[model samples]
Target: MSVTAPSLPAELAARRGSTVELRGLVRDFGGGVGLTGLDLAAGPGEFIALLGPSGCGKTTALRALAGLERVDGGSILVDGRDVTGEPASRRDLGMVFQSYSLFPHLDSAQNVEFGLRMRKVPAAERRRRAAEALELVGLGGHGARYAHQLSGGQQQRVALARALVTEPRVLLLDEPLSALDAKVRVQLRDEIRRIQTELGITTFFVTHDQEEALAVADRVAVMRAGAIEQIGSPEELYHRPATAFVAEFVGLTNRVPGMVAGGVLSLLGAPVPLAAPSADGPVTAYVRPEDVLLAAEGVPATVLTTSFLGAVRRTRVRLEDGTELAVQHGTREHPAPGERVGVALAPTPVTVAPAV
Candidate 1:
């Protein structure tokens, strides 16, 4: 016989999610501002990440969507309905914070049932829902454990169960994996993505971790100075970034001085044809470490350093002209720091910006 999965509660399944739209949202903080007419949208069941450095307004934008922070102008909409003025309690959103906000006195099941209790759910139904939520998070047998008795990862799992048990219209994650260790963060992040996919709820996740954001989100919005600098799929953002900020922020890049003329850039004595329009003058070409190749008959250079990264090794080399660049290679035969070598471009397209 084929095994079948359990079904979600009918009432809960009926309220899966809705499209979220932020129209020129603005939040001011006197001296400068929190958000400067920021606009974003997420389709039903789509996972979107707001990624940026500290104080770039990513968290502020998430808070505004959750109705925790007031917006000074513009509107918030869900499924094409205006909810700009709705209070936090009426917004029907489930939020998970970086800190596991579980009550010390409450066990896992009790914590998961707290929201239902506040909504006046009957005791029997609340118990059933709480049990289901715990099972959903792979913590079904640990419901009797309190926060203090559970590990950090388990506590965060309980917190997630509590937020998800409500079956709210939207799911908001505010750097939920920031507090855990590297391994636990990766494991829990994968779990979160799995659960979100099973439920098909529209999700808005905020984080400063590029790897985490790129791994978990369907699309990433890079923010800067209280505004969105660029938004695109992870591959698009990494490969064809619109600006130098997006190119440098989304991944590691090496800025090399080059000159452009007749739609070709001359870098390190090589001619690279430009795919996009660039000013005919000096420019800073951004090249990824992996795009730099170590060849036997290329620009002569001396190895500076080599760092092992599992399947690949990142080797830094200094050219005859004293220019340094990093090259990633899969071979384990690494040269000494003073050993001579040759480096060349990998024939991949590069991004160029005005020289600074």
Candidate 2:
């Protein structure tokens, strides 16, 4: 894609972006809390999403990097230069929060231009840049509308415009689309990804929604208990999860009891390759719903329920051992509830952790 013209004034173009790194970052919050020597980095212009459940330190880590929170240890570096002591104002980053945070009295254009105005940018240049930023967010003609005058999604676009107007080196997104409706959330999410790609600015997106993280990020950092459990591409995390937590958190995984003897997990009368080497013993095998198939000759199971999901149907089946697993297949062929059927495991690789 061709590079768009500069959205900010000429002098600010050089401040575009730099690689970001966090090393041995530590924060204390009294009782065995805060980021515990967390380490992560983002390549120049790479989009990394910090994903996890609430209180998982994803937000805290984002805040620390934004200079909103102080770290008890480690350093924050931008462009290979340490900026651990820099204030938020000096970080050259833009942040969009969950809330719209738009000025009620200010119109869309003025709101987008607010940051520029604070920096004493010439009024005419600020207007031009604000218009450009609004256009970039697909709100070109709505600059005259106020927060109350715009829809939730539109307001978010304005918030994004305001954040991008100054052309910061890094964009920090903190659940910017969580407040919108499901459809709007998806639409805005795609739009955000598009805009980020267009600008090619390094972005750190903090989100608790697994789908959102998987949909937009170049790499996903799954955090647990103030530390990164795993970091990889979405496909890598989904298809080859590194741990039980990651396998369970990123997507649905059916936990079925199995024997881990001979470096394999014996589940559903079939031996599946283990994700990693585990001592021979009983284990809980993790399998995706799509990997479980209905076969004419296999382990006996009873169909508990079937949900019609447009092109695909999700069937819940209970094995003789009372283990319930979900299976997804075409809606055209579905088993009725209470029907006795044979279930088999697909050839897809499975991950197994010690049964607790």
Best by lDDT: 2
Error of model 2, residue 352, in angstroms: 1.1
* TM-score of predicted structure 1: 0.95
Candidate 2 residue pairs in backbone clash: none
lDDT of each: 0.88, 0.89
lDDT for model 2, please: 0.89
The sequence of per-residue lDDT tens digits that candidate 2 reaches over residues 234-304 is 99999999999999999988998999877767887788877778889998888999999888898999999
Alpha-carbon lDDT of model 1: 0.88
Candidate 1: where is the Cα deviation over 4 Å?
1-16, 273-275
TM-score of the candidate numbered 2? Answer: 0.95
**Every model's TM-score:** 0.95, 0.95
Which 10-residue window of candidate 2 scores lowest in summed lDDT? 1-10
Q: Find the 10 residues in a row with the least total lDDT in model 1.
A: 1-10
